[model samples]
Target chain A: MNKYWHVVGVGIQNTLVYRVNFLFRACFALIPLMATIYLWRAIFASNADSPQIAGYSLATMTSYYLLATIVDALTAVAEDDWQIAADIKDGRISQFLLKPIDYLAYRLCLFGAGRIIYAAVAALPATLFIVVQRSHFLLPSDGLTLVLFLASTVLTALLQFLMSYTIALLAFWVLEVSTFIFILFAFEYIAGGHLFPLDILPSALANALSYTPFPYQLYFPVSIYLGRIAGDELWRGLLIQSFWVATLFGLARFAWHRGIRRYAAVGG
Target chain B: MNASSHSRAFAGWGLLRRYARLYGALWRNSVVREMGFKTNFVLWIFVEMLWFALQIAFIAVIYQHTDRIATWSKWQVVMLIGASHFIQQVFTAVFLLNCSNLSELVRTGRLDFLLLLPINTRFLVSFRQVDLGAFVNAASAVAVMIYAARQLDLEPGIVQVLAFLALCVAGVLIHYFLMFLLATICFWTVRAQGIVWGYYNLFTVARLPDGAFRPGVFKTVFTLALPMLLVSNVPVKLLVGMLESPLEIALLLGMACVCFVISEAGWRASVRQYTSAGS
Candidate 1:
């Protein structure tokens, strides 16, 4: 356990050394922010006098998107899994196999470390910008709401990690995973509510997505932050997220074992 | 003919043939490779379907709130989305994915081999890796366009269809130039992976409707600084009669030409700066 924490520390230090690269990444994440602002501004302009659409005011929508951007930054995970799969294909996983550390734990540590540093340096500042610029937009009515929002954000990060890692592990079987990943990313933009609120989805599609884990990974957390979900609904959302995390965790383990068996048989 | 004009024409034709050959080979290889991964192909098809579903859901949601978005009706917006996808597919199939890998080629000195080829280096490098799978998406986009046109209950005249196709080609050109202009920066910055990622971020703006940007600084930036609107929006508008002014069509063509010239200059400068990893 201590060793895992030490690995996380090392990862954090390593990321700090490349701080400028991380800043560039944060800036890149802001592209959607610019897009959303333009989108909502147009929405408002079209209606002109209307204060609401689909039960969300322009201010609320703006805040939702702003928080979505911050949530996206905080959930940033390692890109090493695809590289790991490539390395495994090339028989380079042996280097990690020879190490004293557990490979999965090491990856988690590194991801945790990067996320911690990123949250502080990038996510925090971006969130602060949102809070300052759109203070009036937030409807944080109580302390419990704030606490639930924070918890949901943390769970959101873990759920996203599991989902991405699971997809990355598919590379063990797939010739190349870029196309699959691109498609998954496109789905994430819509289903995860990063591009727009899931409430905007058609009733049929919205009901379908509720059964999936994508909404919990992004939409649930931002909804909590925006005071859209409350009381029993908030708890229900968290339970769904927790269930997904556990389910995905089991699937990831299965994938890793099967992938490694294949790797060994192929002489990786 | 003058010697210069004759040589220029000859060189252009030669370059075109060389790129076509290389693109053909890459497309064939990619198809064979993807076919071998049967499971992946099936999964990828499903994923593409899911993407189309998601886009449909977005349109559904927008329509739920209002009868129209900006000056365009729901069907018109859907057509625009289809046009955007078409432009994206064409560019991705030919150039976008290849340009994104420029940094790796530069770092490993594979770029030297490409440079040594007898063909024009820019033409060759830009079109080397063809993603044949994008054809699936392109076909899907065309289907969506037809469906949206049907929903609108309008059959575009032959002249309008031809103009739309021309503008779509111009849109693909603008997209290629923007991507290449950014990719060429790899020559100076060896670690341009972030910049490549940043360039995709610019696509988010391109994906949204042009009218989503109000007439102000945002419009100015999209039109002049990045030209994101001209890539898909204007072309789709022209098809739908939302933009019927002759001047608008002329301006879009002019923008495409200017972007190509700027990107060509940038590519030449970057090539000059390319000191191969090998001696």
Candidate 2:
């Protein structure tokens, strides 16, 4: 546990050294957010007579997207699989295997370091967006909403970390994981509500997604923050998020242990 | 004079045959390479199918809240998605890998070897490798397009089909040029990965209908600066309706000409820079 702190320190140093790359990547968050804002603004403007569609007004939807972008920045992990794949492919994982430090914990610290950097880098753009669109911005209506939101968001970050780690473990068997990574990213954006609010989705699909881990990644936590998931739904969303985190953690551990058996297959 | 005309026609035919042979061998090599990892290929195809399904689901979700996004109806949007998949998957299959690798080649000085060959560097760099999995997705996109057309209860006539095909070809060209432009930027910068990735971030908008976004600066940029809107939107519009306006034709042609000219010019400039730098 104490040794992992050093890993985090190393990751922070590395992140700073590559700050330009990270900031360039973080700026990408603004592009999609603007696109969605313009999209919703159009949809709302064209149907100005309707006060609300699916219980969200233009202002609330805009605010929802703005908040969601920040949450995305906080939740997004570093590109973990490229290094994992390279390590597995080049026999470098063997070096880590001989150490007392666990690979998963090291990755978690690195992910933490990335999250911190991303949050700091993303703050400038997010603040600018908030300032320009401050009129449309909405805050948590009450203290409970804010608390529940924070809890669920932390759970979401953990769940996302586990998910990525599990996916990275697949590199143990394959020569390349780029295709799978592409597929994972596409699904994550759609299902995780990074692209749009899940509530705006069809009730049937939204209800179905409620049972899955995807919505908990971005939408549910943001909804909790926006006070959209009130009372029973808030509690249910939190429970479901915790459930996903636990399951993903276990799954990632299982995958790593199972993946190690193939280390010899890398050909001694 | 008759003999000269015949020989000229034969020379043209011979050039065509040479290109066809080149394409055939490149594709065969790719197919054989993927065959070695048949399971990975199949897995990728499966995952792509799943991604396509998820996109369709997203559209269904959007339509549930409203009848139409703008002028485009639900099935029309689905067609846009299908067309987007078709253009992107086919582009990925045919052009993506080679274009993406251009920057890497520049970095490692490997591009020098290709420049040494008696071939067009653009030609060699543009269509070298194929992702057969993406080829499978392109085929599936046709099925999806047909299904969406059925849902819309519209049978495209020959005119509409021809227009759709032409617009799609134009879309592919624009996409290739944009990517090539990104790749060419590597000549100036040591690390151009961010720009390449930024292009991808911008591309997410291309898959959506033009009507989904409003008449704003962002839309203006997508329309004028990038013209990503023309990639999938115009083709779907043509299939659902017809190319009803002359303006649409001009926009498509303008986008095609602009992107093609700019990317080609940039590539030549980059090559000149590379040679002068003595790389």
Candidate 3:
């Protein structure tokens, strides 16, 4: 346990050295926030007299996007699986395999470290900036809802990591894993509700997505923060996310085993 | 001077053939690499299909609430989305796969070998690696565009089709230049991979209907300064007979030309700054 903590500490320290990279990442994360502001401003301008859409007021929607931006920043998994694949390809994994530490734990520690650094430097600042600039849109509401939002956000991150890791394991068989990564990224834009709220989805499609786990990874957490999902809906969403974590965990383990068995380190 | 000019033209043609051959070889190797894990390749196709379905589903949901987005009708928006994906695929196919590899080349000093070659180093490096897998996405997007057009019952005239094709080509050029400009920044900052990722986020705004943005400062910025909307919005509008103004077409062409020149100059500057991996 202490060893794991030590590893995590080291990981955090390592990430802090690359401060500029993290800042750039945070800046990039703001693109969605900017787009949403521009889009909602247009919508509000068009419907100046009518600010409400479905249950959300224009201010609520804007705040939702602002909160969603921070959620996205904190919850988004590491983007580079190519590095891991390269490690496996180049026999670097053999070094890890021989180490006393668990490879999975090390990778998780590294990711957590990066996320922790980002949360401190970028996500928090961006969230504060949004609140400061758009304080008028922020509705003072429930502490309970905020707690649920944080829980859902952490679970979403775990599920996202599991999904990505499962996909990355395909590098064992595939010479290049970039195409798979691209496809995953494209899916995240639509199903993960990064582009728009799932509430705005058509009934048939929303129903279909509800049966799947993609929304729980992003939409559920964002909805919680926005106070769009409450009480029974929040609990149900958490339960769904837990189930996804378990299922994806199983799949990730299976892939890792099968993949690692086939992985012939090509270079020293 | 005349004889030297003729030889240069002949050399240029020979270099083009060599690059073509290299591209063909890369394509074949990529196919074989993919075929080695046939199931994975098939799974990738399904994954892409899933994305297409989700995009259509999102559009459908939005259209159900409102008949129009900005000034774009449901069909027009759908066509635009498909066209943007088609244009995106062309960039993914031609340049994106190689951009990451170029960083690796610079890191490994393999770039020196390319520079020492008789061929144009820029051309060789740019086209050396191609993502043939993106062809599937391109084909699917084109099919979606054709179907969307038919569903809208829009019969494009010859001139419109020609303009659409021209705009698509220009879109590809603009995308290439924009990406190359970003990638060239890597020469200065060795680990500018985040810039590539950040640039894609910019495309998220671009993929949406340009009509959603009011004709103001923002519109001018997007249409001229950044020109993301010109990548697909203009092309789709022309095909749907919505863009009739000569000014709009000229603006798109002008933006493409500017991006091309800026990106070319940036590439040359980056090359000059490059001192090979160890140095």
Candidate 4:
């Protein structure tokens, strides 16, 4: 446990060293939000006869996107996969195997520490953007919604990390995993409601996506906070999200075990 | 013509031919490298195609509700997005990797070798490698643009096609200049990857209809300051026969020229400030 604490400390220090990079990334990540605002404003204005499009007023729609931005800032896996791939490729995992440390737990600590700093650094700019557009921002409907939103957000972070870790485990088999990572990222960007509200999608398509884990990543939590889900639906979404998280965790463990059987410390 | 003037003209032509030959060699080398990683190439094409498909899906969803986004029809907006993709893909194929690598070169002091070369440093650094995979996506974008043209019931003449190609070249130049300028920030920072990617993110505005940006601070800044909105808007407007005035043409050309001059000057200044890693 103490060793894991040290790992968390090291992660915090490492991230602080690149504080400027994170600041630039956090601020620039808002550029897409600006484009979205202009785009939705145009859409709503053009269809003035229809006050709501797909069951969302302009204000509520903007609020959905704004909440999605914050949710992403809090939960998205930035580049942990690439780092893990490098570790596997360079044989740095040998150090962990030799020690009492579990590599996955070690990584989870680092991820938690990194996310803490990232969320802290990102909160300033994200809060400022929300405040500037406060007229369009919506507060959580109630205390239970806020609590559930937080819980789901935690699950989102875990699911994202587990999925990324599993993908990086491919480094054991393939020389380069960038293409695989990028392909998944492209799907995540579209299906995760990062681009738009999943509800705005056709009911058939949205229902199809609901079965996938992607929407559970960004859309489910934001929707919970917006009070768009309740009672049985909310519980079902959380159950599905947790199911994905648990399944990905098992998959990650299986990959690690199989990969370790074939691991050669040749690079090291 | 005087002998001195004629001699100078001959010397300039010789230099131009030399640079053209050098560029040809670089392209050949890049092609060989890309061929060495054939699977990566194919998968990158797949990745880009998927992204393009999703973007089209987003547009389709919006069009289901409203016939027009602002004053532009559905096909017209598709044309604009397709044109934007084409410009971005072409720029990616030619210059994106080069600009992205500039930071690493600076950080490792590898740029010293390029500085000692006889060729112009900027040209050599900016055009060293080409990603042939991106051209596949560019071709897909052209297919979409043609499909959009068909949907709009317009058959562009040869001159119009030539004009469209000319404007695309200008758009690519603008992208290159802006990215190169951002890349040059590596002289001050250890790595300017985030800032350069920020520029990439900001360029997404190019896909949105120019008319969608109501006249205000956002429109003015993106237009006159960043010049992102003009990169794809003007070319598509010309192709769709919606170009409002000659002023639109002037603005894009003027923006391209201004970016070139500023980036050129900025690169020179940054090179002067660059200190080797050892120093």
TM-score of chain B of each: 0.90, 0.92, 0.90, 0.98
State the weakest 10-residue window (summed lDDT) of model 4 chain A: A70-79
Candidate 2 TM-score, C-alpha based: 0.91
Q: Residue A209 CA error for candidate 3 (Å)?
A: 3.3
Q: List model 2 lDDT by residue over A113-210, tens digit each.
A: 98898788778878987998998999889887888888887888898888877887788877778777777777788878876788777678778877
- Which candidate comes out best when scored by TM-score? 4
Over the stretch B1-279, how does candidate 4's per-residue lDDT look in tens digits?
A: 699999999999999999999999999999999999888889889989998888888898888778888899999999998999999999999999999999989999999999999999999999999989899899999999999999999999999999999999999999999999999999998779877888878667889999888998888988897888899999999999999997998899999999999999999999999888953
Q: Of the pair 2 and 4, which is ahead by TM-score?
A: 4
Pick out the ten consecutive residues of candidate 3 chain A with the lowest summed lDDT. Answer: A132-141
RMSD score of candidate 1 (Å): 3.1
As for candidate 4, its clashing pairs are none
Residue-level error in angstroms, candidate 3, position B9: 8.3
- Model 1 stretches with alpha carbons more than 4 Å out: A78-80, A92-100, A120-136, A171-187, A202-208, A257-262, A265-268, B1-46
lDDT agreement with native, every candidate: 0.79, 0.82, 0.78, 0.91
Query: Taking the tens digit of each residue's C-alpha lDDT, what string does model 3 give over B68-132?
Result: 56567778878987988888878888888677566777877788999998777878777776666
Tell me the TM-score of each prediction against the true structure.
0.89, 0.91, 0.86, 0.98
Candidate numbers, best lDDT first, in rank order:
4, 2, 1, 3
Question: What is the number of backbone collisions in each predicted candidate, taken in the order shown?
Answer: 0, 0, 0, 0
Q: Which runs of model 3 end up more than 4 angstroms from their true locations?
A: A40-50, A79-100, A124-136, A166-189, A204-208, A243-268, B1-46, B215-218
| Candidate that beats the other on TM-score, 3 or 4, i.e. the better one | 4
Scanning candidate 2 chain A in windows of ten residues, the lowest lDDT window is A259-268
* Model 4: lDDT of residue A248: 98
Model 3: chain B TM-score relative to the native chain B: 0.90
